[model samples]
Target chain A: MMHQQFQDCIDACNACADACDNCAAACLQEGHASEMARCIALNMDCAQVCRLSAALMARGSQFAAALCRVCADICRACAEECGKHSMDHCQRCAEACRRCADACARMAAA
Target chain B: MMHQQFQDCIDACNACADACDNCAAACLQEGHASEMARCIALNMDCAQVCRLSAALMARGSQFAAALCRVCADICRACAEECGKHSMDHCQRCAEACRRCADACARMAAA
Candidate 1:
């Protein structure tokens, strides 16, 4: 079994990924999906990182620290773009992003 | 505009999300979909958290620090589970996880 700390990070990543997908789907159905392109792109990117980060943590890779750093940066950007939207999904996504970003930062430090 | 650091985090989260979704889709198509249940579930969870974390960071939420901490933990766990599978996609996902996890950790520390 992996260390508890590592496991915790995985959980957070998973949650963040789900939130992003839902937010993206919601955005796609909105009237301004075209305007939300940046948000959509960021959301897609954030989701990808969350998944990758989780996998790396699983194997206890030596490069996980570096990866965490990159993932953290992306999450912040995605949040900013999503925050621009006035929809409930965007607002909820923004909240999730902040939480995930904080979690990733902690893991990197560890 | 958000500080460069925040923007970077968002970018990383979005990338990770895409990787996870792709990996999950590939996993679903594999013959051992039943065996990959845990990975799929973790993938889904990681994706959600990444989205939420990004959104939170976008708004400069005060709770972002805590959220990042959580996101990091989940990423680690999902990585571990995904690593269990011997498929190429799992391996790829594992690598992506490492990258995203490191990125997130950095954001948390910031």
Candidate 2:
């Protein structure tokens, strides 16, 4: 069974990934695609890492601890970048990134 | 400028996330949704973590180094789990995960 902490981290990561993916797509559809290049890039990147970290922790992989540490940093940066835009997608992505970052940070420390 | 190594890690994470997201959708479309419960779960997780790690590294977040460590582990486990199924989607996700895991591992140590 997944530990409570691990589960929480996974939830955070999954939620963040979904948010990023949705936001990226929305950014692209908003016709400001050029301006959203960086945001889209960051969103895509953040979603991937969050998903991977959750999978690793779920399986109790040997590298889970280490991955959590890195995932946390990525989430934070993505949050900051997403936060830069006032678009709905960016705002949502930022929140998700922040939540995932915090959860991953706790997971890393654990 | 984004460091070559960091950029590489971000690429790996992005590729993996795309692979996982596509794979997950494929799994659902194939009507194997019930059987793919675990695989879908893992894919979603892997994609999120990979994305987050890439975003974190792109901007040189303070937590980048630590997050890299966790991202590596997550990628590895996701790869293994995805590799279990012989489906094309699983195969692709597995390959992406392995590449991401290796890239993240090197980045973490650096």
Candidate 3:
């Protein structure tokens, strides 16, 4: 089944999406929210792309790999941006995004 | 502010995404899943795009309108595809997709 075939990537993506969403929301609540704008934007992008990549992979869609490439790009950008922030949420999100980017890159190559 | 500006479209997108995900899962459980392949694919695509559109609009991203345009196109396709099915899930998904498509279109234009 598709789930079995892409379990690791799906799990990674799911985690990353959640992390991105949470980080974005937390960034909004930060005292220096204006400075977190780019991080928030990238987080939103990463979350959406990760969700889409996971869904496509779960269905064994041929376009999954292509989307994975896009997701990886977004995840990496999000991770880098989040890494610049000192907030706990941002730190955690950076880790998740890195993991997801790696997973997505592997999936895209697979 | 972003939420207030895109409230209706965002709500429609969220509802349609839930409906699409449910329809896809239901289709997979159906006895003739092969026959429902297109429906499932469209559902997944619509769900991801809607989620992405909602997130972008929520952030007041400059790209929100462009993504909403794509979301509207996908929603319209998904609605038409789901409308051909007689299953209750499909019917519900079709209605949700139509509403989302309209909402996204309005958001895109605005």
Candidate 4:
């Protein structure tokens, strides 16, 4: 049985990963591919870290706390980068990142 | 410009994700769900971290080195665990995890 905070954080991480994956694919489809390069890159990074954080928590690993701290940092950074873009996918990704970051922060604190 | 090592690590991570995802799903389909609980859980965790590690490398994050170290550790652990199962998916996942762990270790070293 997982703790409530961990469960919530895991859910957020999964959601954020999906959003980031979608955003990266969408960014690739944009006409200005070069311009969206950073957004695309960060989306990939955020998506990966969220998955890592979720998995760590699920297993109740000793490293989960430390890892979640870094994950939160990455999520926030991704959100900031995504927020600069006007694309719908970027917008959605930013929101997911923000939520995941918050959840990770709470989990890390616990 | 990304280095060859990072690129290779990213590729391994992506491959590992696909393998782990398949392994987890297959584990669920096994008649003995309870017997495969640990395998299923580890597969899920391994898949997520592999995604995260790949993304970090793609973005050239400052934290990528440290994250990859932990990622390598998880991949190896997952590989060891997956190696215990006789199923084809588990065998495939173990191979992917082993490759990913080696790639991640090299990345972390560099």
Candidate 5:
């Protein structure tokens, strides 16, 4: 079982991963796929890292703190990129990424 | 777009994640959920790292190789654990994990 302190971060990471996955799929459906390339790419990266960080924390891995640090950085970057877009999916993804980033930062600090 | 060299590994990662998710969900539905706790936990961890490794490779990140090394280790462990179970979901998940581990190993060596 994961430590109680990491539960919120884990939840945030899972939520962000889901949001990012949805955002990437939505971006692919948009008319201007080329325009959303970076967003899609970042979404994929962010989603992966969020999931990995969450799992590491759940397992109580020694590298969880370091992984969370990197996860937070990627989440921040993804959020910034998503914030630039006007699509509803992107907006939602940005919000999720911000929340995950904050949670990951706290986890890293702990 | 990801480099052609990493495409197979990315596909394997995605497939493995799907399999792991299915396996975990199926494990929960079984009569002995407590008995499958380790399997479920490993599935979650394996799924997360596989996604992360795939994204890192897709982005051509400098850390992709190193990450893949760890991912391969986790995938191997997950596969071994899943293989010990008799359920169809576990069998399929074990296969996927093995494939992912192989792909990750190749990626890491590259």
Candidate 6:
């Protein structure tokens, strides 16, 4: 089990990963997917990093904070990219990423 | 659904991710966790990369090949690190990593 302090951040990371994955799939199904290429790439990276961060935290690893920092950075980037889109999936992803980034940043600072 | 060509690689990746995650949690439960610090770190990274690689392949991302190359590299490193340990989890993790590395390498070259 993760430490009590990590539960919120872990939840945020998992939710963000799900959102990113969903958004990426939605983007891929769009007619003009070429225009969403960068969004898809960032979504993949963010989802992966968030999962890693959550896993590390769950294990109580020494590197969890460091990984959380990296996770926050990618989450910020993903949020920025997704925020530019008007699609429902992208907008939801952007919100999730922002929430995750804040949670990870707080965890890293702790 | 992923292309038929990606099925084996995706399966390998998912299995490897499971192994690495299980190993990390097991390592945390073991005595002298400090000795397994590097092993745990590598396991976390390998698991994250494997999941990302699988997700990319599933979505037919253009960068899947490039990410596979990175995934293979990390899998090799994780295998080497886990190979040094005598624990059952570590041994199993090493084997999974090796298999994943081979599968990912083949995907990268495909």
By DockQ, who's the top model here?
4
Worst 10 residues of 3 chain A by lDDT: A61-70
Which 10 consecutive residues of model 3 chain B have the lowest summed lDDT? Answer: B61-70
Q: What is the TM-score of chain A alone in each candidate?
A: 0.91, 0.93, 0.97, 0.94, 0.96, 0.97
Tens-digit per-residue lDDT, B1-99, candidate 6: 438789999999999999999999999897878999898888888888798789878877665776688788879989999999999989999999999
Q: Which regions of candidate 6 fall more than 4 Å away from where they truly are?
A: B1-110
List per-prediction Cα lDDT, in the order shown.
Answer: 0.72, 0.81, 0.88, 0.84, 0.87, 0.88
- For candidate 4, write residues B5-84 as lDDT tens digits: 58889999999999999988888987887888877777777777778777667868766887888878878888998999
- The stretch of ten residues in a row with the least summed lDDT in candidate 1 chain B is B1-10
Give the per-residue lDDT digits (tens) of candidate 1, residues A1-110: 23335766766776666567667766766677898888888888887787677667754566777787888888888888888878887887787787778888988998
Q: What lDDT is reached at residue B58 by model 1?
A: 55
lDDT of 1 at A8: 66
Please list the Cα RMSD from the true structure of every candidate, rounded to 1 decimal place.
14.2, 7.7, 4.8, 4.7, 5.5, 6.1
* Residues A23-109 of candidate 3: C-alpha lDDT, one tens digit per residue: 999999867889999998888888888887888888887567767876787788899999998899999999999999999999989
- Where model 5 places Cα greater than 4 Å from the true spot, the runs are A1-51, A58-110
Q: Against the true structure, what is model 6's DockQ?
A: 0.16
* lDDT per residue as tens, model 1, B35-99: 88888888877767766776666545667667877777877887888888778777767776766
Error of 3 at B90 (Å): 11
Poorly placed runs, candidate 1 (over 4 Å) = B1-110
lDDT of 2 by residue, A18-94 (tens): 99999989999999999888788777767766777787788775566677676777788889989999988789889
At residue A24, candidate 2 shows an lDDT of: 86
lDDT score, candidate 6, position B23: 96
Question: Which scores greater on lDDT, model 1 or model 2?
Answer: 2
Total clashes, candidate 4?
1
Q: What is the DockQ of each candidate?
A: 0.04, 0.29, 0.28, 0.29, 0.23, 0.16
